[model samples]
Structures are given as C-alpha cells and as structure tokens.
Target: MPDGPNTLLDLNQRSREVFRQLVETYLATGDPVGSRTLSKAGSRTGGVTLSPASIRNVMADLEELGLLSSPHTSAGRMPTEAGLRLFVDALLQVGDLTDDERAGIESQLSGSNRTADGPLAQVSQTLSGLSHCAGLVVAPKRQARLKQLEFVPVSPGQTLAVIVFEDGSVENRIIDTPRDMPASSLTMASNYLNARLKGRNFDEAQRRVQQEIDARRAELDELTTRVVEAGLAVWSGTDAVSGSAGRSLIVRGRANLLEDVQAQEDLERVRRLFNDLETKEELLQLLTLAEEAEGVRIFIGSETKLFSLSGSSVIVSPYTNAENQIVGVLGVVGPTRLNYARVIPIVDYTARLVTQLVR
Candidate 1:
C-alpha cells in the first residue's frame, strides 16, 4: 500500500488482485471471505498462488488500512463501507444488461399497454422487480398548460374555479368572492382569461394576463378584474391546479429488503430503512443531489446521512424530458452489498427510457 492521495492506485499487484477477489466474493454471497477461502478461490483464478497463512497476513494489512473488517462472530473478512466505495469507484468492472433483462425492462414499460398507474409508476415497478430492491422515482411536479377557465357560482360568496389543461386534466379550486359580486362577472372574467392564458404555463399565463390588464385590453369593471386576478393567483400559488401539490415519491418492492436478513442486527437495520423510506423528506433531498450530476450516482453505506444508520446504499440517476430538462430522479435503494456491476446499467437504461416516454 502507498501513502498520500494515491492510496488506491499504490496497492501492489498482488494486494490488488487479492483485494479484488475478496470484495467480489463478498458481494456475490453477502458473506465474509476467510483467508482459506480466498487462497483456494484465487488459486483457481490463477491470480493468487499464496498459501492461507500468507493470505491471512494480507487480509490483516487490508483491515488495518480501513479497507476490510472482521465481524465479531467470524474470523472471515468483509469489505468495509470505505472498501466498497474504493471497489465501486476504481476496481469494479460494470456489466451490461443481458438481452433477456433488456426485454424484461422494456416489456414492463410497454407503450399503450401500460397500466393506469402512469409511466413513472411503471418504471418504479419495473426497476424494483429487476433489482429486487426498493425502487424510487420523484415525479416531476405537474404543470399543464392552461386550455380554458370557468367560474361556476356555488353561492353568493363562493365560486368554483374550474381549470382545464391542454392535456385534458381538470382541476377545481373554490375561491371566495365578494358577497355582492354579480353572477355575470363569472362569465366576464372567464372570457377575458381564456382569450390570453390558453396554451401557456402558469408563469407565462400569469405574465400575459398581467400585460393585458396593464394595457387595458381586459375591459372589465374593478370587481371583475379582481375576480380574474384571483383566479390566476389560485393556479399560480401551487401545484394544486394540477392536483399533485405534494412531492410524488413512488417506492415499490419494499418487501425485498426482508429477503436478505441474516441476523437480528440485519433485521433491525432493515426495519430502520423501512422507517427512513416512510419519511421521504430526506430521500427526496438525497435524490435532489443527483440532479446536479450527469449520470448514475452511487451512495454507499454511511455516505448518505439518511441511510447511515441502516448501512444501506442508493444508486440514483436523473431523468429528463424531451426538452432535455431534468424533471425527476429515479433509482434503487438496497443493502450496501448490492450488485453494482449489474444494477448500474439497469438504472442508467431505465432513466433513458423514462426520458423518452415521458415526453
């Protein structure tokens, strides 16, 4: 091993080979790799001809360097979180999705035949099924362009602001009006807004409506003008107009976390993870970090604060729309022992496919 910033690169060829074998074995079985096991396994791979005693010495050295650890119950060695980071960042050779895997992913996202749950939900389900872990997708906030507006009078001082979007989604918000407002003012405001706000997003529609009012093109009495302004304010204030005000975090395959519990400690960790997933504010913040990066981001155990206690890992990627604007994030969460080589490409491809279909 070498000192300074180049520690990972400075490992001797023998140490590197042995370390790689150990990490690979641990990832595959989620079990500690003993010196005897590494010696036999490495000899078969034609990489390490060292005896068990020599292998044990090397394992001790790696453990001292904070790359591996020994569980209290076994003399066998397992990679630490730092070791997994080093492996993922520098040592692991990522694998591509097999043809069958690709077909499976595509079949789940099949166009026109997808379920009523929508594409984002379908993608989450597909990823969860393929990865055998909890899949997460932060759906983009709905911002449909306005098609028409209506103000149906419910009572003397209440009116239902009906908003129709170009995509055919309709939203209704009840707004208070002056008790003495004339019934004819509803139609007046509706006509004035529909004339200029159609086919525009909230911000653009608001700007155009204001411009018309400033230019005096909105010919209405003071009360009718105020009513129109209030109607616009309702949609502009929040995503309530699109009926998705709260953050949309789709998590599927939560039960998969239960599949690999080896002990009481493992069970506790899984339970903590389940609790963490329920309080998604942290997960949403974690996923937001991926939006700034370009491709798949791997967060090993303790790297992300939210999953630190559980010692879990997350692999997230941002998905964009047809305009190439990042609209949401999608990924999987699993134990630190997740199969990165196989999961990385699966996540990347799923994100790309989602981008294409989302538009």
Candidate 2:
C-alpha cells in the first residue's frame, strides 16, 4: 500500500478478518460501519480477537491503503470501489444458491420455446429480483440463413423484396423501381437469384451477384441492376456478414434503485447507470470483449473505456452455436460494488442457457 490507487489486500489473518467483517457488514446494512460494530460482528465468530481500539487502527491502515473511506466528521468507514472489487474477486465466499434461487433461474431459461426475447426478459426480471438492483440483458440479433429471394411489384414505382431464409425467417424491403419496367423484370431477377444464390447467406449472394453483374453488365438492363443493388443494400445492414446491428439491450429492475437501505449519497451514479443503459450500443461494445473470451469475463470499473463514465462493472460470457461458433453474449451490468461471487455464477449459467437454446 505505497501510493496511488491499488487493489485491496490484507496478507495477515487479523487484518483480513477485519477487512472481511467491514465488507460483510456494509453489504448487509448498506451503511457506513464503525469499528465497534465490526468488533461485535467478529466476536460472534470468535475469529477476529481485536478490540475496538485495535480495530480502529486496522481500519485506519486500510483507509490509508485506499481500501476504506471514512465519511466526514463520522466515525464510520465504507469500502471504496477498488476495495469492493478486491472483496468480490478474492475475499468473499458465496455459498451455493438455494433451491428457490436455482428454480427461479431454471424456470425461466429451461424448457421454454419462446422467442429469444422471452428468456432474455425473464433473465432481466430475475436478476433484478435476486440482487435488488437494476438488471440488464442485451438481445442477440437474429441471423437467418438465406433460402430464396422474391421480388413483387407493390406499386407503380415501388417493388417489394421478400427474402425467405432457410430457417423460415422472412424479411422484406421496399425499393424504388424505374418507370415503365416490365413485370417480367421482377420474374427475371427473382429467378436469377434463386438459380444462382439459393441456400447461401446474403453476403455470399451479394459477392457472387456483384461479380455476375459486373461481368455481365453488357447483357443486363438498368432495372436488374437497381433490383440487385437494393437487395444488397437492405441485407448489408442486417446482423450478418455485413455491417453491425449496433446491438440490442434489455434492462430490468430499475425500482431496486429505491432500496431504502443504502444512504442517498451517490444515487446520481445509479441514475447515470440507467441513462447509460438506454444507449445500449456502448454496453454491447463493452461486453463484446467476451466474444473473444474462453469463459466468463469480468470488467471492473476503469478496466475498459466503454464503461468509464459510470464506473460500473460487467460480467459477460459468449454463447455459441452447435458448431462452437460464437453467436451472441449474455451478461449483467451493475455498480462496481456488486456481489460478484453470486452474479458471476448467474452470468455463467445464463451463458450456458443461451448456448443450449441456440444449439
């Protein structure tokens, strides 16, 4: 504990016990803790044999090390963000979830044949209930494989581009048509796409079609080129091998912010957290690091730039398809002082659930 912000550590048994007691009491009551109160909590276990005076000295040392902060003119101390991070990562010992907790999560994630939104919404609600904090879930963009492309004339100057995916997913886009174009033009483009690019993804179709159009420009009319270009532009914006979907987000449990226990000291940070959730692109970028992770990954405050503004923490793990190709991610976002021991396993289990669903 020499200088500027370092993670909390207590090597000796006595110091460690004192530190643990402080964090446990603070978490339980959400209050600034005095040394005498911690001494009583320690005495119940007969683990820490320090007197109040001695505990105060230890707390002073911890505060000096940037582990605990003392309120002005108050004989009480609380853990800083760094201290809470260290407690969650190394010190806290979370027991197995109770049967009810297991059931709550399982009931939502298992044996359900609903849309992707169903399980995700359930996850957000459950997390909020369990943690008494706001919950968040970013929806995974749906990417359906291509089956057929059909163009139908919707109006004199508008045509409907209907793309049917192999998975029975359908997407439609409207494109402007050149005046005096024949109905046969629609038939020609649709037949051409089905003959050449059926069973391929939109990107593959785009590349092959572009090559064909370029090589056979002399053989094609203006209407065909416009139809192909419109189709390509529409598919390019999807969450496939083209541009980004910019990510989807879900947040639950905002009412947990009204928990009456924690003092109304830094409520603004929590407010900022909610506001940040509204702009999910930033959160998705923050969690995207998990796509490259082997297992669950934790990003504490200041660890990544995406979450720097609010000093929040994220626990993320990627979900994969049957082929082991990563498809999406599942995670939680909360204050830096979150119960990592509990939430870490929750996120891990949810990631597995997502994988099972996609597979």
Candidate 3:
C-alpha cells in the first residue's frame, strides 16, 4: 500500500466526485460499487456524468493511488481505510445534532450520583442502543479521602487494619504481627495514621507519612512504623492508592456488531471483535490513551494492533469534570463503515453531557 503523503487537492474534480460517489454508495450498501452502476445512477444517488469506460479508468487510477480496492469475487471497487480517513477528514459533512437528540441524551444521563466513575453502565448502554455498536467507557480513576484507620489483633500472628474512607466505605487488611507484640504499638499506629491519613488519600498520605518517617520526625517505635508501612503497602493497587480505578472498564452490546453482518466474513470479523472486547485489560489500556488526547479520536482498522485482527474501528472522546479537567473517556466500537459524520457528533455530545452531569 502506498503510505506517502496525499490529500484531496491531488485529485481533479471528476476524480473527487467519482471517489465520493463510490465511497458513499459502498458505505450505504456495504457492497462494492461498479463503474456501470455509477454511470446509470440518478443524480440523487450521485451519478457521475461519464461513460462506464471513463468511470472504470477513474477507478483504476484510484486503485493505483491506494485509495480504492477491488474484491477478487467482483470487479467493483470500494474505499480502503486510508480513503475512508481522507474522506472523513475532508469531505464528510457533519451537521449539528438535532435539539430532540440532545434533549434525549440529557434525559438519559440526568442522575444525582457524583463521583469519578459515576453512572458509566447507563451511559455505555445508551450509546450501544443508539449507535448499534459495542459501547465502551473508561471510568475515571479516583481515590476517596482517608477518614480513619485502625489496627485490631485478629489471631496469634495476624492483625487486621480496618480502613475507613471519607466516602463511608471500609476495607480491612490482615497483616502479620508478633504474637507478644504490645497493644500499645497498634494504638500508636492507629494514632499516627488517623492523624495523618484523614484528609488525604492513600497516595498523599504515603508521601507525607513516609517523608516524616524517613526524616525521623514521626514519634513512633520501630514495630509501630512497620505496622504503618504494611497497611500502606497493602492498599497500593486499590483505588485508594492507584491512579486508575479498580472498576474502570465498561463494555456493553457486543452482539450489536452482528446487526450489519452480511456474509460469513462479516460474522468472522464480529467473532474476532468479540474476543478483543473480552480482553478487558488491553481494551481498557487502549481506551485510556484517549484520556491524553484533546478531543474526538478515530482509530481505524490496522491503526491499532488490539483491533487489527478484527478490522474494527474505535471512536472515542474524553469527558471532563466541572473544572474542565478530563476525568474519563466514553465512545463506541464498531465496524469501519460506521457513519462517522453522525457518530462523531454523538460521541462529542455525549462527552459534553457527561461533563455536565459529572459536575
């Protein structure tokens, strides 16, 4: 495939119209467009004022330029992924979403909950229903502020650290302590953390507490320090400590991909896509990349290895919190032929709606 730089300006007016006609027809029918079909087509269907022989020449030129390809089964041509990208970047006409559509989106997302990972399941499910694609969401990573931490002797050599957060959620971690250890050490560890961990999340508390401990500023015995360290370490990967949340990946409506399946190859592609979606860790990692992007991002087939085998596409946009801070991302995953002009605004509008609701 030719990968050198190319743009719409390179094509003459006839070539551009033929390319546009071919792509729009193929996208509408999920079938190849034949030169004869374009020649006899009516104006509404983007009929070109050219003979079949002339249209075939244009098709050959587009194929040579790597903008179109023909399936072995037929002599018709269809746009390649590169061609689709060019069309989206240049020719696609995206109109504003209707007032009813915006109101409907707002109606669906209006809820009272407020947090980083708030109401994601509903949001994704709504996208799937509307777009007829597998809806995906990446919940914001958030750590609740630490409220109180307590140590209680559980067994001969085990102790439980009862962690409480400002959000009223409690988690217990059991650690090993000396059988004859003084109860004063547990009390001392509790006093140290409760005083230090109340207002801060585990990450902030770790930094401050460890700095003080390193500087010998904390008035704690060695055993008590070990107890404190153990509690902190146990919470390392939890939402209380990690930068990403534990429940961050949400995928809905995998079967919606089958709605457009026309052939056995289409079924096979959906099967592969299903497998990719099932791999939540990798998919979530891919979606998290959108968190770093400015606005809507389109990942066409072969652009990302995760969906390369399936020949799928992902259209994502990051949603923001009240302060215009990007908190998470949400979007749809579907076939490359998904109506880009239509769905781009949907994803963008949904992201903005989520931003308003999240705040």
Candidate 4:
C-alpha cells in the first residue's frame, strides 16, 4: 500500500490514473465499480495493468480518505460528492457543442416571440431538450428605454396598456379599471406619463411616474389618478396578476428528471427533488448565488441547501446585459451522477449566446 494521498496533487501517477478511471466508470453507469471491474476496464482507460487485488487496495485507501463510498456489502466503490467536486475542478474534460446542438439553440432563441412571456421560456425549453435535464431560468422582467405608453379600453372594466420600448419590443399588459371608467380619462393618463417617461428606462419610469402622480393628485380627477397608478403599477411589479418581483421562474423538462429516477433505484431521493422544484423562491435564490462567479458554477448535491434533500446537482451560469450586469441565470438540475464533462460546456455556451440576446 502507498502512503496516504491527502490531496489530488499528492496522488502519484498510478493512484491518479486509477482514481480517474474509477470515477469515470461510476459517472457512466451510476453504479459502484468493483476492483475486478476496474482491473478489466483499466486497459481501455490508460492501460493500467494492476491486478484485482492491487485495485482493491487502492479503492480501500480511497474509501478511507472519504473520496469513495460503499453502499452495499459488495466490494465496489462510488465517488462521493467531495470526490466529484475534485474531479470536476481538476479532471473533467468539458466538450464543445455539436453543430446540431448549436443550430438548435439558435433556432429556439431567434424564433421566440417577444410577448409578455419573454424569451427566457424558450431558453429553458431548448436547454431541457438538449441536456435531458430539468432546465431552470431566473428571468427578471425584460427592460428597455421607454418609447411610448398607450391605453385602450378593452371592455367595461379591463383596459389594454400597450407599451413600446426603444429596443423595438412591445408589451401588452391588462389593467383593471373602474367599471364605468371613460376612455378620455385613460387617454389623459397615458399622455401625462408619456410626457414624463419619454426617454426613461423601465425602473426609472416606475419611480418617476408614481412620484408625479402622487405630487399632482389634486390637479387630476380621482378616476385619472387611479389610471395613473395602475399604469405605473405594471412596471413597479404591483400588479397582482404578476405576483412576482417583475421576475419569472421557469423549470422545464421535469419529465427528464423523472427519467433519471426510473434509471436509478432510489425513488425517495427523487421524490424530494420534485418537492424542491416546486419551491421556486428558494431555487431562484440558489441560482442567483451562482452570479457571484464569472463562469459556470456547479452545486452538487448537499452543496445547495435548497435541494439537499433531493441529492441533485445544478449546473448554472449567469447572462448579462450590455452593461455587463447579470440580468438572468440559466441552468439545468439533475441527479448527482450527471454527465458533468458534457453538460458543463453546454451551459457555458448557452449562457454566452443568451447574453447577446440580452444586450
């Protein structure tokens, strides 16, 4: 037996090769790899010629170091979450997207209609289909400089608030109004806002418009004042219909997660995963934390408190606007044994592409 290798750097060539081969096998099959299986597989990985007895000794050492675990009485070992982190940080061989995948992502993002739903939904769909994992996205409301704001009565108590942005995007929001509200009052409210929010961005318009309405309330009739508040309310995230901070949470491809559960023997862990996805606020908060880093971030199993019960992993990246501010986050969630080497680059490439659309 060799001296204990505390860190990856401490591992000699033979130990490193054996460790890599074992981890790769575990990731591929999501099963423990016995010493005999590894001995037979060694030739394929790097011509490792150790006997089964020699391989067993190495696995025992790895187990003692907390890098591998034995789930059964069988003489097999599987990499633990800490081992996976080490592999991802040092040995994972990230691959580039295929031509077909690149084409697929481009088609999805470019073909999406910029409706109230925005393009983020399309992104999640594309990622889910391509990655075969549950795709998650944290989308702040679409932003653009104010071009114009108009109000048209749709019915007795509902009006259409048509907003045009400098980026050539149009958004239509429905506002509830007094049952007998007149069209002239809606027009007066729209004109007043257009005068003040001509070149302001969404957030700025939200603040200034509300302040103006409150300051000049005496000059306007009660009906007109109500319209003004409702108009700015749409931007300030006060609309109950939205019920979010002008931000949307989308999780696509949950069916993909179910497929993983079917492949693995553990049903209880995956059931917990479904419950975690339903907790969108906590999941969104987890994704937001990934923005602190520059590139793709991996939160494996217990590393993310929100999904710790699920024994799941998240591969996420943040998308930024022209000012390089992180405006959205996109990623996938799956079992801890996900094909990290393949999925990491997919996330990295998708995030870059989304950044262009955001700009």
Best by TM-score: 3
Model 1, total clashes: 0
Q: Which stretches of candidate 1 lie above 4 Å from their native place?
A: 1-7, 111-117, 148-162, 172-197, 203-247
Q: Worst lDDT window (10 residues) for model 1?
A: 238-247
How close is each model in CA RMSD to the real structure?
4.8, 4.4, 4.0, 4.9
Writing each residue's lDDT as its tens digit, candidate 2 over 1-359 gives 44424333344667778888888778766678998897787688875678999999988888887788887888999887667777876787856677786777788767544764777777667667776666666565555568788999888888898988887877787877886768888887787778766777666777788887788853457887777677666666443333345346667887775564254445766767667776666666666678776887888777877666776787777888889888666667776667777877777776777777768
Model 3 stretches astray by more than 4 angstroms: 42-47, 111-118, 150-162, 171-193, 209-247
Q: Estimate each model's TM-score.
A: 0.79, 0.77, 0.82, 0.77
What tens-digit string does per-residue lDDT give for candidate 1 at 1-359?
Answer: 32222356767777788889999999999999998998888778886789999989988888878788899979899998888888888899998888898888877887534433477888888888889999999887667788999999899899999999898878888987998999888889999888877888777878887888899977899899988888987766533432233346889999998998989999999999999898776677788899898999999978988999999999999999888999899999999999899889999999988888888
- Candidate 1, TM-score vs. the true structure? 0.79
List the candidates ranked by lDDT, beginning with the highest.
1, 3, 4, 2
Could you tell me the lDDT of residue 140 within candidate 2? 59
Query: 1-359, model 4: which lDDT tens digit per residue?
Result: 22334468867677777788889889898788988898887766655679999988888878777778888796789988888887888878888888987887888889987775557888888888888888988887656688999999999899999998887878888999998998889988888888877788768877776676668743578898898888877765666655355667888998887774544446887778889998876676788898899999999989989887788899999999999999888999998999998888888889999999878
Candidate 4 lDDT score relative to the true structure:
0.83
State the lDDT at 253 in candidate 2: 80
After superposition, candidate 4 runs with Cα above 4 Å error: 1-6, 145-199, 206-245, 262-265
lDDT accuracy of residue 154 in candidate 4: 91
Please say which candidate is ahead in TM-score: 1 or 3.
3
The lDDT of each candidate is: 0.85, 0.72, 0.84, 0.83
